[model samples]
Target: MEVDDEIGSVESKVDGVGDRLCSVFSRSHWDSIKDSPHELWIVFVLKLLSSYSYFSFALVLTLFLSTEFQMSDVEAGWVYGLYGVFSTVFGVLCGWVVDWLGVKWSLFFGAILGTIARLLLCFCTAPRSAVIVLVTALPFAESLGIPVMTIAIKRYTHTSNRTFAFALYYSCMNIAALVAGPAVDASRALFSDGVTLPLTSIRLSALRVVLFTSAVSTFITVLVVFMGLREIEVNEDGEIMPYHPPSRQVGAWKATVRVLKEKSFWRLVLFTLLLMGVGLVFRHMDSTLPKFMLREFGGSDDAEGVPFGMVYAINPAMIIVLVPLVGMVLTRVDSYTMIVRGSFVAAASPFWVALGAHYWAVCMFVVTLSLGEAVYSPRVYDYTMQLAGRGSEGVYTSLASAPLFAVKLLTGGMSGWLLERFCPEHPPPERNAAALWSIVGATSMLSPILMVILQPVLHPKQSPNIIPPVLNSMHHLEDDNASEGHNSESSNTGESDAEYQTGFGNLERLRRQHSSSNSSSSSSS
Candidate 1:
């Protein structure tokens, strides 16, 4: 009743905020979005601009390393892999920065670093220099950028409206990706033979042109953060207000340690790690597909035939059209179930590529993959928010990115080997492209299969025997409290029992109480 009343109060506040914001979204979503603060819109623009810049350069990062540095597919893959590995590591290490500095300053810091990295790319001619730039500043910039953006989405909207808020956030990213496709192809086509500046003998490649453009977009992002955004938080009454962490806040390291000690954190870690298999397919799209399209189809980067950017653009294009629809339709589905269903669909996409080396096959792969992604990816962010404790969203969300680190580690060297063996720079008549994709397809099947097998364990309320001994002890403690008359009349034992179940947020709260009690006992002793 209290929850319902809170949601109702939130809705009443939203109803008076303003008129419908965007007609493109369905009527089902308008109630949720109409009340969104102007700051949320600023975040939308920032995400669009920053994402467009990042993806435009990322879409060709592997190609640039291979061509400009005169590195083989294997060497470039290792370098690209290192970039992904370190970037994710930096993200994990520095996610607390967002929690410490708030969204506004974090955006400024990350965007400036990104701008500096992109500018360096335009002039750096040596492989070692490129490697240093990619693994250091670029990683830190990317690491800080995403978690804070998502945290902004969480804060700038009402709790009841967070589903649509995250969906819109996902759509903004895809929309930017969609725009980057043409920008990439156009930049390459216009600067086909490369261009030399009047005063200097240095010539700029198509890749460098894209990087330079991306750099300018990143600079604009910094300006948006400076001029258009202010740090804000949703208050206890569910109203938007200026940002402040709690007065008794611990340092970032202590906070992280407390989070680590929670059983829920381990559960989140296991869930994300299980997700690494399907995650690899997304990584492969960037790492492997460009080379596949170019080599298998015999097309030059500047040529009209088989534009990789356009082909890559197809996924995000479909996502932009499908996300809102999926959200409206699947509003009642549980997050874990959605993940299972979506993983099944995504896992099958690579098998389409296994069918042949044809353009139609790759297109089918992307279309199917996008369909599954549209169903599940936004929910992943939403689900993480559910798991996070108050003031800890940034760290929890960053830890949720743990799967990508594994995926990157696997895809880098694996993609290079797959390409060399089957879809090499020069393909022979007997090249077995089918075998390569077949391996990818088969490996991706692991995630869904394992998820299905582990269902009983993941949702412990359904099968109590599968609960670990630690959970059993926790349950015993609750039982003792109830027996000792510590239970309140309003206590919901079923809800309490399901703390170890998936998709509940208060597990963190419960663990904290348990920890505080233990600490108090120790101090008394």
Candidate 2:
């Protein structure tokens, strides 16, 4: 009878211990997630407004150069190409500046510059000189926008949640791209119809009206950043703390160089260069495809013939549908794999473009290109963070934008020259198709090739000190406290059960003793 009673007691104790452990584990897991710092909804709003304004400007700018300025495909290409080059150069500088000045200031400066550039476009009459100045100023001014926004999101978000944050960011950009198409198209149609002002004496071209609208949009973005956004502060001990002014003066150049020295950083830079090179092939599709359709596809050059404006609509539309889905998938898949797959799809876009016999075929190719973008776009920043490791998120994020700068410098002038040379003044269908295919095919292939080579280099290695020493010290202190608690519990457990029971009176009293012992054990454990 005594043996059976003791067995029952043992069983009850085991159950009790198991229940306690399970409760502890559940609490720990919940705490971990709850403590993670990601304001997903707020980040989403910022991304939406920023992307909307930026892409809206791009859509208007493209349409204005093509229609109002009466620029040829080659001339329009050069003008836009120059804008890209300037933006690229300014982007490199802005990446460093974002780290030094803080994201808010960087964003504010970029927005102001962008607004001014757009407003200037409204008043300028000489297309050549105006195009040159706007091209130069707009990109440089806009350079700060993306890098600053990226840094802000990174600083505020947690590692596990960052991929989703970026995905949301990319989605907003695509959404903007989608909205810009109809907006620009409508503006053009309205302006062409000569809609008179309600009270003003000024006559306006559709292009002027669009430029003014773009400037206003930029100003609104500036207001949002300044008024709606809050700065995130990092503690000197290298932990995320409440927003406070930084005391230590860190030079942007030093931070940039430190980032450059990391092997992973270069690997990511190479990957971005490849990705941008590939994406640039598609960027040109908006400017080049319309002209190709007009000259070679037997489309009328009149508003109806390969309406270039219509092609712009396809990418944005596809992006709106695809981006959210891609964001959810990013949580499960390896980002590098997504990038590789996207590159392969992009490389194949030219073949699709070449295969297009009808306008629908052209539209299909554009759709394919946008699909590739949907997959690739979200992963770019996620990969940059991985490459950044710990202290260099700002630098890596900025570097991701570098490819846009580099590709434009290397290919912009050449693309313009090539179109002028190979695409005839009045291109036949065959010649136009060939030129478009060649450009897309060559540029698209480069991204995949570079990505394959860089992938091995980009793989994450064990980082020795991603978290700062001070943060690590605090973690060790907590661990020590926990360890001491566990040690005390174990020491108490060594005491006789009879002695505990004799002193405590009942099972409930024994449980209180056990709980105290266990609390100490937990500290050690």
TM-score of each: 0.81, 0.72
Which 10 consecutive residues of model 2 have the lowest summed lDDT? Answer: 496-505
Global local distance difference test of model 1: 0.72
Work out how many backbone clashes candidate 2 has: 11
lDDT of 2 by residue, 78-159 (tens): 6777787777667776666666566677677888887888777876777876776665778777777766667666666543
Tell me the whole-model lDDT of each prediction, alpha carbons only.
0.72, 0.58
TM-score of 2: 0.72
Candidate achieving the largest TM-score? 1
lDDT string for model 1 (188-212, tens) is: 7888788886798988988888888
